[model samples]
Target: MACTQMNCSKNGTTSAADLTDDLIIEILSLLPVKSVCRFKCVSRLWYLLISQHRKRLPQTISGFFYPKHRYNNEDGLIGFPTFDGISGDQKQLFPDSSLPFLTGYRQILPKDCCNGLIFCLCWKDSPIDEADYVVCNPATEEWVVLPDAGHKSDALAYRLGFDGAMSPHFHVFQILEGDEDYGYISGVNIYSSETGVWSYKENGWGDNEIQIVDMRGVFFNGMMHLLTCEFKILAVDTEGKTWRTISLLETMCVGNICLGPLAFIGQSQGRLYFINMRDNDSSKLSVWILEDYNGNEWIFKYSISTSQLFGKLFGEKDHMLQRDYADLLLQRDYALVAIHPECNLIFFVWRCKDVLLSYDMDRGKVCVICSLKYHLYDTFPPYLPYVPSFLRIGKPRVEA
Candidate 1:
């Protein structure tokens, strides 16, 4: 707390050369990274302090708070409402589902989650009317939107990714829809919180004419994975302006196996697993491992005939929402840990509710972690990871 001063009264006459780098970094830690970044423009000392600590700031914050949480930071992507309609745009914390205090995040779409913040994009008209792309922290309820990346076309694709290194960083890849031959192609623009502006460039290979655009970005294997199509997974490098593809499931292996939609299964122990459910209209189910983001290997696992997890996984039921419920999610441990009310009409009487399960990455099998209404198998006790929705004070520091 004493690392940072209230006003940093050392701005004007005090030459930053007089202060040791360690002391400068310490001061920045006492304050929020966002604040340090904002103050970087003041002088070289301030800039160094802010830039030098940008990499360590997130770690510092995570270390400080991860242990403090009942669920810690090892759980899956915590789902919570970003926009409140019933509460009239209120950012107040509530306990209906996710952590009560995990609110105030803008454009809360499931694109990419890193460290402690989630990134999203919002687009529309202009200045007084134009929308924005936001990267935010639900825990601290902090958010920052990106500036436009010189796009002339209305169609655009924003993919957020993270790179793991000494200075692990998160970046957004924005692909503007434009002509590639006539040179109107607005390449993948990069945006970093540490470096606020989006670097303009040209579109990379296989990054054009994407028929299926999956807004749900999966950060896996040191790259960002997005379901580009049933046969391809677009992987973007978070550190560089390069985009590539990674094979999830081979088309020749299972005749007509398609890549399922991606969702955060959970990040237990030390791995980040993506839950993808594949359903068939022939009254059958299949689940595949979407590969864990941040892992060190290219492991693609699949579960065929997954009728065990979600009863009635195929046939007419699978084709219900051709596009809506395209695939089923293999909810894993610590994920879907709480009550998830969605998709009614399960087993004719039991409503379709989200449940927790243990996924065998090696065997493609799923074991229920909680009890279901119909006792899909057997009634298991629910897990209470810290009481939901308790007003924990802010991170003990705040300033505009």
Candidate 2:
């Protein structure tokens, strides 16, 4: 008689040979990026499925990458972990995790995240004349330091592009500011991981004075979007090598970014968003989405009332929602960071109060995510939406 069960209980459990391909893919898709990476070692079939699952399902924001604080003496890439609640509607923050990178000679500053890769700038200690521009996939712990592109500007910005399903490779775009015969010109430089080289596109910013007002760049519609100090939207097409400038709605508050980089632009569910917190009316905040990109139309989405969202913070003594509470949010010490792409969640950090808060747009609930004690300066910790993936750059490019 054959044995009913194998005697492998003492060693370990058996493999999931009974699971079908469709079922395996579905289960792996819901897991976190870190777990997916570890499961690759389970079996060859699981590894293949986890590697290609991004093409089967939609990708959402994983978490955020930032330093502890800008003014603080500590140095390195840091992680602000996010969690999923049992109720599905609730989310919470976990303990901070520091990213592994060299500490002494080089200081890493997290910049942009495209697809699932993060772009960081590594500054040298001694001379400090040139900085190392590096790109990394935090989930897989894969990083590469880019070669010198020969452009030296402190106000430069970066964007990464990759189509994991169509191609196993990715590229980086660097937007640079230069003075020309006419005026300031923003140039574009593209670095291909496959070729291991950088290509330049001169005069990328035609006639427009591209201001480096925002610290991060929004990647959407095959282009990189950034806000200028002049209140105009500056876009650079990575594929077409073109530039376009769209005017913001004409208002007294336009171009007045006195509250630092609080006024931000982000992309959610393929729709471009512009959060206008620069308004003097601090009680209500406005959100704009790019309804018609070709027509340069920005439609009003919604307005959130701070009086209702943060009323409890003021306490029962100040029961009558005072208008000054809104003013407090508008101060330069406050900022609006990441906006969830799939939902109405917004992340805000109040440096003066030393706290990070998340506001749910649908439920109208505000939750304190964490304390800013570790990240305390005016511009200490820079926040960027983090997405985890198993993509490996510099691999052979596949045909679409």
Candidate 3:
């Protein structure tokens, strides 16, 4: 951590300019993401250094964005306040005006966030003509409109991916569901910011055995993991240009455990994890890991008991728990919102709750990280783990 120009002579003849570029980059990378972003105005050298090291620096969960939880929709979209994950403090209140491009749009739906850029479905006043997919970099306040997929479908889901440290470009994957003669047809379309073009692969999913059930996708190790209604996992390989499905064990589909909403798939430590919140009992959740892809081997990892989670989170207030996570959620009125892919943590949002809670799987501890400022009544809002960056879309940078 030594300053490179510390030995320079006193007369102000030497400054940060006298320091080696490598040393400056090393020093700047040590600063917080927001601080580094502000220092981009210092000079072109600093801008390049900060932009290059943004991804290499420690990647922390910056905040969460929920588009659904707002006071009113008539007075424009109310910006949700984001809180810090580490400090459990309010970070910033994002107003609608800040995203000027979204002005006049009736519905602003967030699809995904990857390396700081957000992929959203912006539907204008008219449902047909103005509906389009937009990519926005909230940190830089820059956005780009993606080209159309050339066909219409009944259902749609999207996933975003980028490596800002290695490249300024990013990619978006669109999974479309439509009816066909057989039963259903699912297609995959890819949009690249670098090329400004949409590549379509019809019948992306050959078999109609199980269609993608939801929009939430886990992007890990160059693949996007999607869940199906039949307790199956669909992986869209962006690099390999292929789609494959992984079936859950028959034991997972029998009885109340077969319920799809009671389970979720998360990636941790470079592997896929299948978590099943017990339906009959709210006091436990089962965790499974995918050991082999081809052989379809899933090894049981461990079971997390809610007895401790409940005692720690809700205190000594005990009640009869039935119907598993939902009943526990009804008693405690806490909703299981999301799970982090890079770590052993699960996020929960309570009914009429403003705060976001994180439970560490390894430590068996739960703590408040931030506030949502919105209530979870019928459904959880469109939420995603966001990590801010200084990646510029139009600005020239090396492609990864």
Task: Report the poorest 10 consecutive residues by lDDT, candidate 1.
Answer: 340-349
Deviation in angstroms for 150 in model 3? 1.3
Off-target runs (Cα >4 Å) in candidate 1 are 1-112, 120-130, 163-168, 179-186, 239-241, 252-304, 312-351, 354-400
Candidate 2 error regions (>4 Å): 1-59, 69-96, 101-106, 124-131, 152-155, 161-167, 180-183, 252-259, 278-280, 320-322, 395-400
Better of 1 and 2 by lDDT: 2
Q: How many residue pairs clash in each candidate?
A: 12, 1, 2
How close is every model to the real structure, measured as TM-score?
Answer: 0.45, 0.72, 0.72
Q: What does candidate 2's lDDT look like per residue over 62-133, in tens digits?
A: 556665433334544423222222122223322324445434334566767776677777676666566777
Backbone clash tally (model 1) = 12
lDDT of 1 by residue, 1-400 (tens): 2325432344444445557778777676556434665777988867776675554442311110110112215333332222211122222332232323323332123344454445543433233234556655554454565666665664455665543332334577665657644323245566665566666656565445553333345455555555544455556565546667545443321112122122223232234333333323322332333344434344543443434434433345555443334223332211222111111101101123433244444444444433322222122122222111111222312234
List model 3 lDDT by residue over 1-400, tens digit each: 3445365546645578777877777786666555666788988877887777665554456667666545564644443323334352426434442355555566666767776788877777665347777888876778787776675775466778775655677878777666654324467777777777767776655575556554467766566777776677777766437677788863232122212244667666557888766545555777788887567799987777766665565554443332234344533445455676467788766544556778888888888776555433355555566766765777322347
TM-score of 2: 0.72
Q: 61 in model 2: Cα distance from truth in Å?
A: 2.3
* Local distance difference test, each candidate: 0.40, 0.63, 0.63
Question: Model 1, residue 15: what's the lDDT?
Answer: 46
Off by over 4 Å in 3: 1-56, 68-90, 93-107, 125-129, 165-167, 180-183, 204-206, 250-261, 278-283, 291-297, 317-335, 352-354, 375-377, 395-400
